[model samples]
Structures are given as structure tokens and as C-alpha cells.
Target: MATCEADCDAAPVPLKIMPKDYVYSLLEDPQRILSPPTAVGETLGIRGSFEYFHYGCDGHQDAGWGCGYRTLQSAISWIIRRRDSSSVSVKDQHVPSIREIQQILVNIGDKGAGFEGSRDWIGTLEEFYVIDVLYQLPCRILHVKELGSAEALAQIRSYFEEYQGFIAVGGISDTASKAIIGYHCSAETGRVYLLIVDPHFASVPSCRQQLIDEGYVRWVPVDEFPAGTYNLCLILQP
Candidate 1:
């Protein structure tokens, strides 16, 4: 999303498939590492599987503003590998890089195949457009006016229960964009927690456990989230 030196006019690069262990969902031991509150009642996570994408994963100079792109890339990877892919349809099968993503958006517009790259950072709304463009996939956007309210948390829980796909969560106070892959409810204290996978930083992980150790993927309390007005981009996979 920012400072990507990839050529926007060059041919699209196919997403490199990492080893199964490198993928986030395939990594075990998160249950062994977590120190969640004993007050939680139910815990839910993403249904199928997903791969992790981050700032420096693909050799881009994107450190500050590439979070939205990384988040969207991970979501697309999950859709491509989902179990119900018999019905899945997309303009392209392989994942696209930052340059390709910008190119696709420009092509769909009146840019006429001439897109000058900018340093603009994309948010959850831009992610929605990218999914619609590449996958022709319909998505849902949930606006949370209040960050930690029970009603908002309930809606998030419902989405996890029904869809079980990764969601991109952006907020007014949250400087970084995060993907919500799990949810928990504390019956005793009526508190809710979110299992978020952050796509920030430039760490080259040797294994998935490194990410967990560094807190790139973990459970965060909803109360700790930034002040209100969170936009959730939910990609609906077929």
C-alpha cells in the first residue's frame, strides 16, 4: 500500500506457494502458547485455512502502509484453497502482488492501462473493491460505531459462526489493519476477545511459531481496540 517499488506495468507475478508449515493455519501449538482469560466461554476461529502475508514477505518496500494489501492477499489465498472451491470463480487463480493489485484497479477504471503508482494507503473499503475486481466476489462491510459494545461484538461473533472466513478490521484509532480469525466470549464478565492476525512488521519467520511468539497472531481484547468506528471487510467465498 505504500512505498512498493514493484512496477505496476509489469506482468503480474504469481503468488509463491510457501511450505505447508509456513502457512498460518497449518501451524499448530497456538493452543499451547495462549494465556487467555479463564473467564471465556466459547472460542471460535476461521473455518478452513489461510496463509500469512505481511509487509516484507514478498520483497516489497512496503512497511508503513501495506497492511491492507497484505490482509487482502491472505484472504484471497484462503479463498483459493477453501474446500468448497468447486463453486468458486475468479478472473485469476493465482494471488497478485501490490503492483498487480494497483494495475487491476486502474484497468477497471478509466485509467486506460496507464497507472502511475502513488504512495496512497488503502483501507478496508479498498480491500472490498479489490476482492470484487479479482474474484468477482461479493463481500459484506460491517461498520462498528462503538468498538467494545456487546451488540457490535455479537455481530462479529455471528459472522464468525456463519461465514468463518477471515475479516479485515480497520479503525479510527488503530494504526495497523488486522485480520480477525477468531472470537471469544467471556460468560462470567461479559467480555469479548478477538483473535487477530496482524500483517505489519518485516520479520522473516522461520516457522509459524515465531509469529505467535512475536505476537503477530494472538487474542486481543475488544476493549483494547481503538476508539469506535471500525470497518470490517468480510469477503464472502462461494
Candidate 2:
């Protein structure tokens, strides 16, 4: 199986150009999901072999756009209807579950929709899913509005100001854990800068470290920050 880094960098494998007429059949048969376990010794002889090829070796490179199904619901339907009865194995390395696969498809679909002029749904979905999956929390209306506002610039700044500590900690959690922190400013340029710091996993410390490492230079403890202070300067771009 390809390591995360390798899959991220390699050129995406082209899915076997199956005939158009067979698309439905392929989706209907789980055995066709990829290479079957029994055919492990043979080259290109498994069910869903194409998917595994792309997922394991290509890091789901074509995840969001090329595949026929675009929405999460459609992807789930495809998985459940087609692969459930086939002898495909979920135990293999790099095999994505129904949820993971759907998420990937949703990301791609969402991106395509955005670039093709569906910014509202795309932005909302992006924010919604990121928070939902990462933090297991439903998005508040305020959060959604801020994310989609024409004043994205002001909102982002305000977010940093109000949640500087939370931003530093990366995210909220019942238990502390390390976080990968980053920030982007659309005002100067659409670039994201990553921070460096080793806060405890799922803990405030990890989030804090993530912010510091990512170039948040003005971070302070929540207790130390003034109660009414708001607005933060953007200083890093990546």
C-alpha cells in the first residue's frame, strides 16, 4: 500500500476506461468494486481493483470530479447497491469505507460546484463538513453566515480576534490532541500558512501550538487576553 505521502504526490492512476454501457453493471456488482482477494496473484484481476488502484496508489486523485457520481448520497447509493453483494473485502489496506468514500466524493463534487459557480453551497458544505467531521459539531447559523459573507475578509479577521486562543489551539475538543493549524488571508493573497507547535492531542495546547507554528505571532492565553479585544492582523502567507 502507498503511504499517505506517496499517494499524495504520485500521478493519479487512470481508471480503466470501462465501456459506457457497463457503468451501471459495474456499480451494481460489488465483486466488481476492485480486485477480488482470490485474484491477488493476478495482475488487474480483482473487483474494485480500479478503485483500489486509485485509492491505494493514487490517493483518491480522481476522487472529486472524474467519477460519474458527484454527491455523497449518490456515492453511498453506488456503494451500497453495487458492492454490497459482491465479494469485495473491506479489510484490505487503504480501502475506504462507505462514509470515507462518500466524504471524498462530496469534497470533489463540492469543489467542482464551487469552481463552476456554486459558491454558496460549496462554501457552506465545506465549512459544515469540516467542522462536522473534525469537531463533531453542527454548524451554527452565525458560523455559516460568516463563512459565506461578502465581508469574508472582516469575518475572518474577527474570527482570529475572538478565537485567537481557540485558533491557536486549532480546534475544541473534550480531550486534548495535537492539531495541524493553518490560516489564509484573501485580502493580501489566497495563500495558507501553516503554524508549528506541539500542543497535546485534542487539547487546547495542541491548538495553540498549531497556531504559533502556522505564523500567528500575537497569540496569548485566553485568560490574559483583554475581554473586549477584537481584530487581528494577518502576517503570514503560504
Candidate 3:
């Protein structure tokens, strides 16, 4: 037997640290995580219950049946009850009120607020929640992962390319990152819009220019695009 100077057990084995790319490559396709857009109406009604109740005022009620719920809390409850009732399916139709449409807008705003305030956002939590709700199914919320600068946009683009249909909402800024703006895209319409929380105050145009220059996005004048919805592509950097 050979006499060893050190005990084999005494030396600690080094743990392998995975490179970010290797870890990223291991991730499941982002598109697979999304519920098909066919479920949008239902998901909107469910997740946006709060909006149904709050924004679906008399003006909204006059506009549609979906406007019956007059408070966000009530709308949420209604959605929950509907889910439990087993009578309503995604295909089971119900006329929504104008108020319901208004609620949708409000809910989108609320979502933006939540995203901005969240301390940890890896994109997974929101994605899972949206998928589960849309599918009328449940799933485990996994570990959160943060996207680095410009990485978020890349992720969004990948998701869109794979799914071919879905909306993407993001906080975008110029190279400086100081002048930031939020954007929302409609997959079906292929339309993208610049959202301003405060219309009285506007983001610097230079910021938008910066995003274009960096090849993070392409800018189309509002007049040319005309804003309802249009097909578009993500212009990535070389």
C-alpha cells in the first residue's frame, strides 16, 4: 500500500459553476410556456376581474354585458366563480360590455405597475401565471431569472418568433437607460405602441432614437403605423 501524505477525504472537491449560456440553453422553449392566443378572451376576463369591477362603470355597462361586474375585486371573484362553476368554457360565449373593454386597459396598466415594483422578475413567474390562467390549468412557479441589459428584449423576441402569436410588454430605454419608456405589442395585430403613464410628461425622443441606433428596435412614426395593430419584426443587433 502506498502511503499518502494527505487524506483523500480531506481535500474538498470544487463545485462546477455553470456558464450563463449553458444554463440558458438548458431552458425550455419560451414559446412552449405560453398558452395559445385562443385563450386570450378567457384569460383577460379572469386576470382582469379587478378591471371589470372598477372601470366598468355606467358608461361601460351601457356598452356591453361584460360590464356587469363593477369593481376589480368583484370581477376577480366572478372569474374565480366561473372557473369553479364548470359551466363556462373558453368557447362558451358571453357578451362583454364596453366597460369590460375599459377594464382590460386598466388591468394592463395595473400589470405594468406590478412589474415595475417587483424586486425579483425573471420573466418566469408572469409567464407561468399567464399560461396557467389561459389554460385553466395549474403549474409550479419556478426559480426567477433576471435578464441583463438588452437581454429582456432578446427574450421577448425569441418568444414571439417561436410562438408566432403573443403579446409582449416591456420597459425599454435608450443606451443610457436613464430615459426609459414602456412598450406593448399585439401579436395578432402586429402593432406596437409607446405607452405613457403621464401624458403631460413625455419621454425624450432621443431615447427612442438610441434604442433604434442600438438595433434593439426599429421606430416607425405614429402617423405611418397608425396604431391599431400591424405585423412587425424584431430588428436585432449584429
- Top model by lDDT, which number? 1
Clashes in each model (backbone N, CA, C under 3 Å)? 0, 35, 11
The alpha-carbon lDDT assigned to residue 176 of candidate 2 equals 18
Residue 119 of candidate 2: its Cα lDDT? 19
Model 1 C-alpha lDDT per residue in residues 106-212, reported as the tens digit of each score: 75562445443655567887777666665556677777777677777777788788888778888877758888888887778767888888888586667767787
TM-score order of candidates, best first?
Answer: 1, 3, 2
lDDT of 2 by residue, 1-238 (tens): 0001101222222222121221112112112222222222211111121211111112222333312111222222223233334444321212233234344435535344224321112222333333333223332222222222335334444444443211211111211111112223333333322221222112122332343344322212223322331222111110
Q: How accurate locally, in lDDT, is each candidate?
A: 0.69, 0.25, 0.26
Stretches of candidate 3 exceeding 4 Å from the true structure:
1-90, 93-131, 137-148, 168-238
lDDT of 2: 0.25
lDDT of 3 by residue, 18-122 (tens): 211111111111112223233222121011111112222222222222211221122222334334345544334232333232333234342543433222222
Report the poorest 10 consecutive residues by lDDT, candidate 3.
Answer: 171-180
Off by over 4 Å in 1: 1-40, 83-92, 110-116
Better model by lDDT: candidate 1 vs candidate 3: 1
